[model samples]
Target: MINLNHLNYCYRSGVNVLHDITAEIEPGIHLLMGENGAGKTTLLHIMAGLRYPRTATECTIDDVSTSLRLPSVLSKVFLLTDDMVFPYPTIAEMERYHAPFYPNFDAALLAENLSEFGINPRDSINNFSLGTRKKAYLAYALALRTDILLLDEPANGLDIDSKTVLLRMLSRNITDNQTVIISTHTIWDFQNLFDGVLVLSQGRLVLAEKVWTIVKSLAFVNSLEPISNALYLTQNMGRFQAIVPNDGTLDTAIDYVLLYTALHSPQQSIITQTVKNAR
Candidate 1:
Protein backbone atom coordinates (compact mmCIF):
# COMPACT_ATOMS: atom_id res chain seq x y z
CA MET A 1 0.00 0.00 0.00
CA ILE A 2 1.04 3.60 -0.60
CA ASN A 3 0.67 5.73 2.55
CA LEU A 4 0.65 9.51 2.22
CA ASN A 5 0.56 11.54 5.42
CA HIS A 6 -0.09 15.27 5.28
CA LEU A 7 1.86 15.68 2.07
CA ASN A 8 2.58 19.25 0.93
CA TYR A 9 4.62 20.47 -2.04
CA CYS A 10 5.75 23.89 -3.28
CA TYR A 11 7.78 24.99 -6.27
CA ARG A 12 10.90 27.18 -6.30
CA SER A 13 8.68 30.23 -6.87
CA GLY A 14 6.92 29.32 -3.59
CA VAL A 15 3.68 28.34 -5.29
CA ASN A 16 2.08 25.57 -3.29
CA VAL A 17 0.83 22.81 -5.59
CA LEU A 18 -0.36 20.12 -3.21
CA HIS A 19 -1.83 20.77 0.24
CA ASP A 20 -2.04 18.36 3.15
CA ILE A 21 -2.95 15.46 0.88
CA THR A 22 -3.31 12.22 2.82
CA ALA A 23 -4.59 8.98 1.38
CA GLU A 24 -3.76 5.28 1.74
CA ILE A 25 -3.75 3.91 -1.81
CA GLU A 26 -4.24 0.18 -1.65
CA PRO A 27 -3.21 -2.36 -4.26
CA GLY A 28 -5.69 -1.78 -7.09
CA ILE A 29 -6.55 0.50 -9.98
CA HIS A 30 -7.25 4.00 -8.58
CA LEU A 31 -8.49 6.95 -10.67
CA LEU A 32 -6.99 10.36 -9.93
CA MET A 33 -9.44 13.08 -11.02
CA GLY A 34 -8.75 16.79 -11.07
CA GLU A 35 -9.12 19.78 -13.35
CA ASN A 36 -6.24 21.46 -15.12
CA GLY A 37 -3.73 23.06 -12.70
CA ALA A 38 -5.22 21.03 -9.86
CA GLY A 39 -1.79 19.47 -9.02
CA LYS A 40 -2.50 15.93 -10.25
CA THR A 41 0.79 15.74 -12.12
CA THR A 42 2.71 17.21 -9.18
CA LEU A 43 1.13 14.68 -6.82
CA LEU A 44 2.12 11.84 -9.15
CA HIS A 45 5.68 13.16 -9.30
CA ILE A 46 5.87 13.35 -5.50
CA MET A 47 4.59 9.78 -5.19
CA ALA A 48 7.16 8.56 -7.74
CA GLY A 49 9.96 10.44 -5.91
CA LEU A 50 10.63 12.61 -8.96
CA ARG A 51 9.54 15.64 -6.86
CA TYR A 52 10.01 16.14 -3.14
CA PRO A 53 7.35 17.26 -0.68
CA ARG A 54 7.69 19.71 2.18
CA THR A 55 9.37 18.79 5.48
CA ALA A 56 7.39 16.91 8.14
CA THR A 57 5.44 15.06 5.45
CA GLU A 58 5.49 11.31 4.95
CA CYS A 59 5.10 9.51 1.64
CA THR A 60 5.91 5.83 1.55
CA ILE A 61 5.19 2.74 -0.51
CA ASP A 62 4.91 -0.34 1.68
CA ASP A 63 6.89 1.43 4.45
CA VAL A 64 9.71 2.52 2.08
CA SER A 65 10.16 6.29 2.05
CA THR A 66 9.79 7.59 -1.51
CA SER A 67 11.71 10.79 -0.73
CA LEU A 68 14.88 8.70 -0.30
CA ARG A 69 14.77 7.67 -4.01
CA LEU A 70 16.59 4.48 -3.14
CA PRO A 71 17.39 2.13 -5.98
CA SER A 72 15.27 -0.51 -4.34
CA VAL A 73 12.32 1.85 -4.23
CA LEU A 74 12.94 3.20 -7.72
CA SER A 75 13.00 -0.30 -9.20
CA LYS A 76 9.51 -0.95 -7.84
CA VAL A 77 7.95 2.27 -9.09
CA PHE A 78 7.33 3.61 -12.63
CA LEU A 79 5.96 7.02 -13.62
CA LEU A 80 4.78 7.63 -17.19
CA THR A 81 4.22 11.32 -17.78
CA ASP A 82 2.04 12.64 -20.61
CA ASP A 83 4.87 14.32 -22.48
CA MET A 84 7.36 11.45 -22.57
CA VAL A 85 10.51 11.50 -24.68
CA PHE A 86 12.64 8.48 -25.49
CA PRO A 87 16.42 8.66 -25.44
CA TYR A 88 16.84 5.64 -27.66
CA PRO A 89 16.00 5.68 -31.35
CA THR A 90 13.92 2.51 -31.22
CA ILE A 91 11.87 0.57 -28.71
CA ALA A 92 14.24 -2.41 -29.04
CA GLU A 93 17.21 -0.22 -28.07
CA MET A 94 15.32 1.24 -25.16
CA GLU A 95 14.49 -2.23 -23.90
CA ARG A 96 18.12 -3.36 -24.24
CA TYR A 97 19.40 -0.36 -22.29
CA HIS A 98 16.76 0.36 -19.62
CA ALA A 99 14.89 -2.89 -18.99
CA PRO A 100 17.62 -4.17 -16.67
CA PHE A 101 16.76 -1.54 -14.07
CA TYR A 102 13.40 -3.21 -13.54
CA PRO A 103 13.91 -6.62 -11.95
CA ASN A 104 10.56 -7.92 -13.21
CA PHE A 105 10.61 -6.47 -16.71
CA ASP A 106 8.88 -8.82 -19.14
CA ALA A 107 10.18 -8.65 -22.72
CA ALA A 108 7.56 -11.12 -23.92
CA LEU A 109 4.80 -9.03 -22.41
CA LEU A 110 6.24 -5.93 -24.04
CA ALA A 111 6.18 -7.65 -27.41
CA GLU A 112 2.58 -8.66 -26.85
CA ASN A 113 1.55 -5.15 -25.90
CA LEU A 114 3.35 -3.60 -28.86
CA SER A 115 1.73 -6.05 -31.23
CA GLU A 116 -1.68 -5.26 -29.76
CA PHE A 117 -1.07 -1.55 -30.25
CA GLY A 118 0.31 -2.10 -33.79
CA ILE A 119 3.62 -0.47 -32.82
CA ASN A 120 6.76 -1.57 -34.65
CA PRO A 121 9.56 -2.24 -32.16
CA ARG A 122 12.39 -1.51 -34.64
CA ASP A 123 10.92 1.79 -35.89
CA SER A 124 12.48 5.01 -34.65
CA ILE A 125 10.49 6.45 -31.77
CA ASN A 126 11.18 10.00 -32.93
CA ASN A 127 9.46 9.27 -36.23
CA PHE A 128 6.30 8.03 -34.57
CA SER A 129 3.34 10.36 -34.16
CA LEU A 130 2.27 11.58 -30.73
CA GLY A 131 -0.34 8.86 -30.33
CA THR A 132 2.04 6.18 -31.55
CA ARG A 133 4.76 7.33 -29.16
CA LYS A 134 2.34 7.29 -26.29
CA LYS A 135 1.32 3.76 -27.21
CA ALA A 136 4.92 2.59 -27.49
CA TYR A 137 5.94 4.05 -24.13
CA LEU A 138 2.77 2.79 -22.49
CA ALA A 139 3.59 -0.74 -23.68
CA TYR A 140 7.02 -0.47 -22.07
CA ALA A 141 5.65 0.93 -18.83
CA LEU A 142 3.14 -1.91 -18.48
CA ALA A 143 5.75 -4.59 -19.14
CA LEU A 144 7.91 -3.23 -16.31
CA ARG A 145 5.48 -4.85 -13.84
CA THR A 146 6.32 -2.22 -11.25
CA ASP A 147 4.69 -2.33 -7.85
CA ILE A 148 3.53 1.28 -8.17
CA LEU A 149 2.55 2.50 -11.67
CA LEU A 150 1.65 6.16 -12.13
CA LEU A 151 0.30 7.35 -15.48
CA ASP A 152 -0.52 10.98 -16.28
CA GLU A 153 -3.05 11.70 -19.04
CA PRO A 154 -2.29 8.38 -20.71
CA ALA A 155 -5.23 8.50 -23.12
CA ASN A 156 -4.62 12.05 -24.31
CA GLY A 157 -3.63 11.21 -27.88
CA LEU A 158 -5.37 7.94 -28.55
CA ASP A 159 -8.14 7.20 -31.02
CA ILE A 160 -11.29 5.29 -30.16
CA ASP A 161 -9.89 1.84 -30.99
CA SER A 162 -6.60 2.57 -29.26
CA LYS A 163 -8.43 3.62 -26.12
CA THR A 164 -10.34 0.34 -26.12
CA VAL A 165 -7.12 -1.60 -26.60
CA LEU A 166 -5.46 0.33 -23.78
CA LEU A 167 -8.31 -0.43 -21.40
CA ARG A 168 -8.20 -4.11 -22.32
CA MET A 169 -4.47 -4.22 -21.68
CA LEU A 170 -4.84 -2.62 -18.26
CA SER A 171 -7.74 -4.85 -17.26
CA ARG A 172 -5.87 -8.01 -18.20
CA ASN A 173 -2.36 -7.11 -17.01
CA ILE A 174 -2.90 -5.46 -13.61
CA THR A 175 -2.03 -7.90 -10.81
CA ASP A 176 -3.28 -7.73 -7.23
CA ASN A 177 0.21 -6.82 -6.01
CA GLN A 178 0.40 -3.80 -8.32
CA THR A 179 -1.04 -0.39 -7.47
CA VAL A 180 -1.87 1.66 -10.57
CA ILE A 181 -2.80 5.33 -10.13
CA ILE A 182 -4.00 6.99 -13.33
CA SER A 183 -4.38 10.78 -13.42
CA THR A 184 -6.67 11.71 -16.27
CA HIS A 185 -9.34 14.28 -17.07
CA THR A 186 -11.13 11.73 -19.25
CA ILE A 187 -12.67 9.60 -16.56
CA TRP A 188 -15.27 8.05 -18.88
CA ASP A 189 -12.51 6.27 -20.76
CA PHE A 190 -11.72 4.01 -17.80
CA GLN A 191 -14.60 4.37 -15.40
CA ASN A 192 -15.23 0.64 -15.03
CA LEU A 193 -11.58 -0.03 -14.15
CA PHE A 194 -11.59 2.21 -11.09
CA ASP A 195 -11.52 0.41 -7.76
CA GLY A 196 -11.03 3.70 -5.95
CA VAL A 197 -11.36 7.42 -6.75
CA LEU A 198 -9.29 10.40 -5.58
CA VAL A 199 -10.40 13.94 -6.34
CA LEU A 200 -8.14 16.95 -6.07
CA SER A 201 -9.64 20.42 -6.21
CA GLN A 202 -7.64 23.63 -6.03
CA GLY A 203 -4.60 21.80 -4.52
CA ARG A 204 -6.60 20.01 -1.84
CA LEU A 205 -7.81 16.40 -1.77
CA VAL A 206 -11.56 16.71 -1.38
CA LEU A 207 -12.53 13.08 -1.80
CA ALA A 208 -10.74 9.76 -1.40
CA GLU A 209 -12.81 6.59 -1.15
CA LYS A 210 -13.27 3.20 -2.68
CA VAL A 211 -15.75 2.86 -5.55
CA TRP A 212 -17.90 0.48 -3.52
CA THR A 213 -18.09 2.93 -0.62
CA ILE A 214 -19.06 5.83 -2.83
CA VAL A 215 -21.76 3.81 -4.62
CA LYS A 216 -23.14 2.68 -1.29
CA SER A 217 -23.35 6.20 0.08
CA LEU A 218 -24.73 7.89 -3.01
CA ALA A 219 -26.93 6.91 -5.97
CA PHE A 220 -26.13 8.14 -9.45
CA VAL A 221 -29.29 8.69 -11.43
CA ASN A 222 -30.40 9.92 -14.85
CA SER A 223 -33.78 11.58 -15.26
CA LEU A 224 -35.63 13.52 -17.90
CA GLU A 225 -36.38 16.24 -15.37
CA PRO A 226 -34.28 17.80 -12.63
CA ILE A 227 -34.16 16.06 -9.27
CA SER A 228 -35.61 18.30 -6.58
CA ASN A 229 -33.83 16.66 -3.62
CA ALA A 230 -30.59 15.68 -5.31
CA LEU A 231 -27.43 16.46 -3.42
CA TYR A 232 -25.99 17.47 -6.78
CA LEU A 233 -27.52 17.77 -10.24
CA THR A 234 -26.54 18.79 -13.73
CA GLN A 235 -27.88 18.62 -17.28
CA ASN A 236 -26.11 16.26 -19.67
CA MET A 237 -26.92 15.24 -23.23
CA GLY A 238 -30.41 16.71 -22.94
CA ARG A 239 -31.02 14.64 -19.78
CA PHE A 240 -30.52 15.49 -16.12
CA GLN A 241 -27.89 13.59 -14.16
CA ALA A 242 -27.93 13.79 -10.40
CA ILE A 243 -26.48 12.42 -7.21
CA VAL A 244 -28.94 11.56 -4.48
CA PRO A 245 -28.69 9.78 -1.13
CA ASN A 246 -28.94 6.02 -1.64
CA ASP A 247 -31.72 4.42 0.37
CA GLY A 248 -30.51 0.86 -0.22
CA THR A 249 -32.91 0.45 -3.13
CA LEU A 250 -31.90 -0.33 -6.70
CA ASP A 251 -28.31 -0.38 -7.89
CA THR A 252 -27.62 2.47 -10.32
CA ALA A 253 -24.70 2.56 -12.68
CA ILE A 254 -22.09 5.20 -11.85
CA ASP A 255 -21.92 8.20 -14.13
CA TYR A 256 -18.32 9.24 -13.49
CA VAL A 257 -18.57 12.40 -15.57
CA LEU A 258 -21.55 13.62 -13.62
CA LEU A 259 -19.97 12.66 -10.30
CA TYR A 260 -16.85 14.62 -11.15
CA THR A 261 -18.89 17.60 -12.29
CA ALA A 262 -20.79 17.60 -9.02
CA LEU A 263 -17.60 17.47 -6.98
CA HIS A 264 -16.43 20.66 -8.67
CA SER A 265 -19.77 22.43 -8.61
CA PRO A 266 -21.14 24.78 -5.95
CA GLN A 267 -23.23 21.99 -4.41
CA GLN A 268 -20.06 20.01 -3.50
CA SER A 269 -20.57 20.49 0.23
CA ILE A 270 -24.01 18.90 0.15
CA ILE A 271 -22.78 15.80 -1.62
CA THR A 272 -19.77 15.54 0.68
CA GLN A 273 -22.02 15.83 3.69
CA THR A 274 -24.33 13.12 2.41
CA VAL A 275 -21.40 10.77 1.86
CA LYS A 276 -20.04 11.60 5.29
CA ASN A 277 -23.37 10.91 6.94
CA ALA A 278 -23.65 7.57 5.17
CA ARG A 279 -20.12 6.66 6.27
Candidate 2:
Protein backbone atom coordinates (compact mmCIF):
# COMPACT_ATOMS: atom_id res chain seq x y z
CA MET A 1 0.00 0.00 0.00
CA ILE A 2 1.20 3.53 -0.82
CA ASN A 3 0.01 5.98 1.82
CA LEU A 4 0.37 9.76 1.99
CA ASN A 5 -0.69 11.99 4.87
CA HIS A 6 -1.09 15.74 4.55
CA LEU A 7 1.46 15.78 1.74
CA ASN A 8 2.53 19.28 0.62
CA TYR A 9 5.12 20.09 -2.04
CA CYS A 10 6.45 23.01 -4.11
CA TYR A 11 9.30 24.30 -6.22
CA ARG A 12 12.19 26.61 -5.27
CA SER A 13 10.19 29.71 -6.28
CA GLY A 14 7.91 29.02 -3.26
CA VAL A 15 4.96 28.21 -5.44
CA ASN A 16 2.71 25.76 -3.61
CA VAL A 17 1.51 23.35 -6.26
CA LEU A 18 -0.10 20.67 -4.03
CA HIS A 19 -1.79 21.44 -0.72
CA ASP A 20 -2.66 18.94 2.02
CA ILE A 21 -3.06 15.90 -0.17
CA THR A 22 -3.82 12.43 1.17
CA ALA A 23 -4.66 9.02 -0.26
CA GLU A 24 -4.29 5.26 0.23
CA ILE A 25 -3.28 3.66 -3.07
CA GLU A 26 -3.19 -0.09 -3.01
CA PRO A 27 -3.04 -3.07 -5.36
CA GLY A 28 -5.30 -1.88 -8.12
CA ILE A 29 -5.25 -0.02 -11.43
CA HIS A 30 -5.93 3.66 -10.61
CA LEU A 31 -6.24 6.65 -12.92
CA LEU A 32 -4.98 10.10 -11.94
CA MET A 33 -6.59 12.77 -14.12
CA GLY A 34 -5.74 16.46 -14.30
CA GLU A 35 -5.01 19.17 -16.80
CA ASN A 36 -1.49 20.45 -17.38
CA GLY A 37 0.28 21.83 -14.25
CA ALA A 38 -2.15 20.08 -11.91
CA GLY A 39 0.75 19.01 -9.66
CA LYS A 40 0.38 15.37 -10.68
CA THR A 41 3.98 14.96 -11.81
CA THR A 42 5.35 16.76 -8.75
CA LEU A 43 3.25 14.52 -6.54
CA LEU A 44 4.60 11.45 -8.32
CA HIS A 45 8.21 12.60 -7.83
CA ILE A 46 7.60 13.27 -4.16
CA MET A 47 6.12 9.82 -3.75
CA ALA A 48 9.05 8.26 -5.59
CA GLY A 49 11.49 10.09 -3.28
CA LEU A 50 13.16 11.81 -6.21
CA ARG A 51 12.40 15.17 -4.58
CA TYR A 52 11.61 16.25 -1.06
CA PRO A 53 8.56 18.23 0.00
CA ARG A 54 9.17 21.50 1.86
CA THR A 55 6.35 21.15 4.39
CA ALA A 56 5.21 18.38 6.72
CA THR A 57 4.56 15.16 4.81
CA GLU A 58 4.68 11.43 5.31
CA CYS A 59 4.76 8.88 2.49
CA THR A 60 5.11 5.21 3.12
CA ILE A 61 4.88 1.86 1.40
CA ASP A 62 3.36 -0.63 3.84
CA ASP A 63 5.68 -0.18 6.83
CA VAL A 64 8.63 1.27 4.90
CA SER A 65 8.81 5.08 5.06
CA THR A 66 10.00 7.32 2.19
CA SER A 67 12.25 10.35 2.46
CA LEU A 68 14.67 12.12 0.15
CA ARG A 69 17.49 10.92 2.37
CA LEU A 70 17.05 7.28 1.33
CA PRO A 71 16.06 5.86 -2.04
CA SER A 72 15.80 2.33 -0.66
CA VAL A 73 12.06 2.55 -0.17
CA LEU A 74 11.69 3.65 -3.80
CA SER A 75 12.70 0.35 -5.37
CA LYS A 76 9.15 -0.83 -4.85
CA VAL A 77 7.97 2.17 -6.87
CA PHE A 78 8.68 2.45 -10.60
CA LEU A 79 8.46 5.93 -12.14
CA LEU A 80 8.03 6.13 -15.94
CA THR A 81 8.14 9.48 -17.71
CA ASP A 82 9.05 10.80 -21.19
CA ASP A 83 12.48 12.07 -20.16
CA MET A 84 14.39 8.77 -19.75
CA VAL A 85 17.82 10.43 -19.14
CA PHE A 86 19.62 7.44 -20.64
CA PRO A 87 22.94 9.32 -20.89
CA TYR A 88 23.96 8.54 -24.49
CA PRO A 89 23.83 4.78 -24.21
CA THR A 90 22.50 1.94 -26.37
CA ILE A 91 19.43 0.03 -25.23
CA ALA A 92 21.57 -2.98 -24.30
CA GLU A 93 24.01 -0.72 -22.50
CA MET A 94 21.15 0.89 -20.61
CA GLU A 95 19.82 -2.47 -19.42
CA ARG A 96 23.23 -3.66 -18.33
CA TYR A 97 24.04 -0.39 -16.61
CA HIS A 98 20.75 0.54 -14.98
CA ALA A 99 18.63 -2.60 -14.55
CA PRO A 100 20.44 -3.60 -11.38
CA PHE A 101 18.97 -0.70 -9.39
CA TYR A 102 15.49 -2.26 -9.25
CA PRO A 103 15.85 -5.54 -7.36
CA ASN A 104 12.71 -7.05 -8.85
CA PHE A 105 13.62 -6.05 -12.42
CA ASP A 106 12.89 -8.91 -14.81
CA ALA A 107 15.47 -9.03 -17.59
CA ALA A 108 13.49 -11.60 -19.53
CA LEU A 109 10.35 -9.47 -19.49
CA LEU A 110 12.33 -6.45 -20.71
CA ALA A 111 13.71 -8.42 -23.64
CA GLU A 112 10.22 -9.64 -24.51
CA ASN A 113 8.70 -6.12 -24.53
CA LEU A 114 11.61 -4.74 -26.51
CA SER A 115 11.09 -7.46 -29.07
CA GLU A 116 7.32 -6.95 -29.09
CA PHE A 117 7.77 -3.20 -29.66
CA GLY A 118 10.47 -3.78 -32.33
CA ILE A 119 13.04 -2.04 -30.14
CA ASN A 120 16.34 -3.94 -30.29
CA PRO A 121 18.44 -3.88 -27.19
CA ARG A 122 21.48 -3.50 -29.50
CA ASP A 123 19.94 -0.33 -30.97
CA SER A 124 21.33 2.88 -29.57
CA ILE A 125 18.96 4.96 -27.46
CA ASN A 126 19.73 8.00 -29.64
CA ASN A 127 18.75 6.03 -32.74
CA PHE A 128 15.20 5.44 -31.55
CA SER A 129 12.30 7.84 -31.94
CA LEU A 130 10.62 9.41 -28.92
CA GLY A 131 7.82 6.87 -29.10
CA THR A 132 10.23 3.95 -29.26
CA ARG A 133 12.27 5.26 -26.34
CA LYS A 134 9.15 5.69 -24.28
CA LYS A 135 8.08 2.17 -25.16
CA ALA A 136 11.42 0.82 -24.04
CA TYR A 137 11.16 2.58 -20.71
CA LEU A 138 7.59 1.39 -20.31
CA ALA A 139 8.67 -2.14 -21.07
CA TYR A 140 11.39 -1.90 -18.47
CA ALA A 141 9.11 -0.38 -15.89
CA LEU A 142 6.51 -3.10 -16.29
CA ALA A 143 9.13 -5.82 -15.93
CA LEU A 144 10.22 -4.34 -12.59
CA ARG A 145 7.05 -5.81 -10.99
CA THR A 146 7.10 -3.18 -8.30
CA ASP A 147 4.45 -2.75 -5.64
CA ILE A 148 3.65 0.72 -6.98
CA LEU A 149 3.96 1.93 -10.59
CA LEU A 150 3.76 5.60 -11.53
CA LEU A 151 3.38 6.44 -15.22
CA ASP A 152 3.43 10.12 -16.34
CA GLU A 153 1.79 10.51 -19.73
CA PRO A 154 3.05 7.10 -20.78
CA ALA A 155 0.82 7.17 -23.85
CA ASN A 156 2.18 10.33 -25.44
CA GLY A 157 3.73 10.13 -28.94
CA LEU A 158 2.87 6.43 -29.23
CA ASP A 159 1.69 5.35 -32.64
CA ILE A 160 -1.71 3.83 -33.11
CA ASP A 161 -0.32 0.30 -33.18
CA SER A 162 1.96 0.87 -30.19
CA LYS A 163 -0.85 2.46 -28.28
CA THR A 164 -2.97 -0.61 -28.86
CA VAL A 165 -0.16 -2.83 -27.66
CA LEU A 166 0.44 -0.59 -24.64
CA LEU A 167 -3.20 -0.77 -23.71
CA ARG A 168 -3.24 -4.53 -24.07
CA MET A 169 -0.16 -4.83 -21.89
CA LEU A 170 -1.63 -2.76 -19.08
CA SER A 171 -4.95 -4.56 -19.13
CA ARG A 172 -3.25 -7.95 -19.17
CA ASN A 173 -0.03 -7.19 -17.30
CA ILE A 174 -1.46 -5.82 -14.08
CA THR A 175 -2.49 -8.29 -11.39
CA ASP A 176 -3.89 -8.16 -7.85
CA ASN A 177 -0.40 -7.86 -6.39
CA GLN A 178 0.43 -4.52 -8.01
CA THR A 179 -1.06 -1.02 -7.98
CA VAL A 180 -0.69 1.13 -11.10
CA ILE A 181 -1.09 4.90 -10.84
CA ILE A 182 -1.20 6.55 -14.25
CA SER A 183 -1.04 10.36 -14.40
CA THR A 184 -2.17 11.67 -17.73
CA HIS A 185 -4.49 14.08 -19.57
CA THR A 186 -5.43 11.16 -21.84
CA ILE A 187 -8.08 9.88 -19.48
CA TRP A 188 -10.25 8.92 -22.42
CA ASP A 189 -7.60 6.47 -23.48
CA PHE A 190 -8.22 4.58 -20.25
CA GLN A 191 -11.96 4.27 -20.95
CA ASN A 192 -12.86 1.14 -18.95
CA LEU A 193 -9.29 0.29 -18.10
CA PHE A 194 -8.76 1.89 -14.71
CA ASP A 195 -10.14 0.27 -11.57
CA GLY A 196 -10.50 3.68 -9.88
CA VAL A 197 -10.19 7.43 -10.52
CA LEU A 198 -8.39 10.30 -8.81
CA VAL A 199 -8.76 13.89 -9.95
CA LEU A 200 -6.52 16.73 -8.87
CA SER A 201 -7.64 20.31 -9.34
CA GLN A 202 -7.00 23.76 -7.79
CA GLY A 203 -3.96 22.37 -5.98
CA ARG A 204 -6.17 19.89 -4.20
CA LEU A 205 -7.38 16.34 -4.40
CA VAL A 206 -10.76 16.99 -5.95
CA LEU A 207 -12.00 13.43 -6.10
CA ALA A 208 -11.02 9.86 -5.38
CA GLU A 209 -13.29 6.87 -5.66
CA LYS A 210 -13.61 3.45 -7.19
CA VAL A 211 -14.70 3.50 -10.81
CA TRP A 212 -17.57 1.16 -10.10
CA THR A 213 -18.82 3.32 -7.24
CA ILE A 214 -18.59 6.63 -9.10
CA VAL A 215 -19.86 5.28 -12.39
CA LYS A 216 -22.88 3.92 -10.58
CA SER A 217 -23.66 7.34 -9.07
CA LEU A 218 -23.12 9.88 -11.89
CA ALA A 219 -24.30 9.52 -15.45
CA PHE A 220 -23.00 10.77 -18.76
CA VAL A 221 -25.65 10.55 -21.45
CA ASN A 222 -26.28 12.13 -24.86
CA SER A 223 -29.24 14.27 -24.03
CA LEU A 224 -31.73 14.96 -26.79
CA GLU A 225 -32.14 18.49 -25.39
CA PRO A 226 -29.52 20.86 -23.97
CA ILE A 227 -28.90 19.88 -20.35
CA SER A 228 -27.34 22.90 -18.74
CA ASN A 229 -29.21 22.46 -15.46
CA ALA A 230 -26.79 19.92 -14.05
CA LEU A 231 -23.92 20.72 -11.66
CA TYR A 232 -21.43 20.56 -14.55
CA LEU A 233 -21.86 21.03 -18.31
CA THR A 234 -19.50 20.81 -21.29
CA GLN A 235 -19.80 21.40 -25.04
CA ASN A 236 -18.49 19.60 -28.04
CA MET A 237 -17.78 20.88 -31.57
CA GLY A 238 -21.51 21.29 -32.12
CA ARG A 239 -23.26 18.93 -29.71
CA PHE A 240 -23.72 19.91 -26.08
CA GLN A 241 -22.92 17.32 -23.40
CA ALA A 242 -23.62 17.10 -19.69
CA ILE A 243 -23.37 14.83 -16.67
CA VAL A 244 -26.61 14.13 -14.82
CA PRO A 245 -25.75 14.47 -11.17
CA ASN A 246 -27.07 11.58 -9.00
CA ASP A 247 -25.77 12.64 -5.58
CA GLY A 248 -24.38 9.08 -5.18
CA THR A 249 -27.70 7.36 -5.76
CA LEU A 250 -28.01 4.71 -8.48
CA ASP A 251 -30.52 6.83 -10.34
CA THR A 252 -28.29 7.37 -13.42
CA ALA A 253 -25.39 5.90 -15.32
CA ILE A 254 -22.43 8.09 -16.43
CA ASP A 255 -20.44 8.31 -19.60
CA TYR A 256 -17.31 10.34 -18.76
CA VAL A 257 -16.72 11.84 -22.22
CA LEU A 258 -20.26 13.13 -22.42
CA LEU A 259 -19.87 14.70 -18.98
CA TYR A 260 -16.66 16.44 -20.04
CA THR A 261 -18.29 17.78 -23.20
CA ALA A 262 -21.24 19.28 -21.33
CA LEU A 263 -19.06 20.86 -18.65
CA HIS A 264 -16.67 22.41 -21.14
CA SER A 265 -19.27 24.07 -23.41
CA PRO A 266 -20.03 27.75 -22.59
CA GLN A 267 -23.51 27.82 -24.08
CA GLN A 268 -24.40 24.60 -22.30
CA SER A 269 -23.07 25.98 -19.05
CA ILE A 270 -25.40 29.00 -19.16
CA ILE A 271 -28.34 27.07 -20.53
CA THR A 272 -27.91 24.49 -17.80
CA GLN A 273 -27.84 27.16 -15.08
CA THR A 274 -30.96 28.89 -16.40
CA VAL A 275 -32.88 25.64 -16.60
CA LYS A 276 -31.87 24.64 -13.06
CA ASN A 277 -32.78 28.04 -11.60
CA ALA A 278 -36.20 27.94 -13.28
CA ARG A 279 -37.03 24.52 -11.87
TM-score of each predicted structure versus truth? 0.96, 0.84
User: Which numbered prediction scores highest in TM-score against the true structure?
Assistant: 1
**What are the runs in model 2 whose C-alpha is more than 4 Å off?**
55-57, 68-72, 227-229, 246-279
Each model's total of backbone clashes:
0, 16
Which digits, one per residue and each the tens of the lDDT, describe model 2 over residues 33-104?
766787888878877877776543466777566664355777778788767466646767767777778788
What's the lDDT for all of these models? 0.89, 0.72
Per-residue lDDT tens digits for candidate 1, residues 150-191, read: 999999999999999999999999999899999998888997
Worst 10 residues of 2 by lDDT: 270-279
Off by over 4 Å in 1: 277-279
Model 2 lDDT on a 0 to 1 scale: 0.72
Worst 10 residues of 1 by lDDT: 53-62
Tell how far residue 273 is off in model 1, in angstroms: 3.3
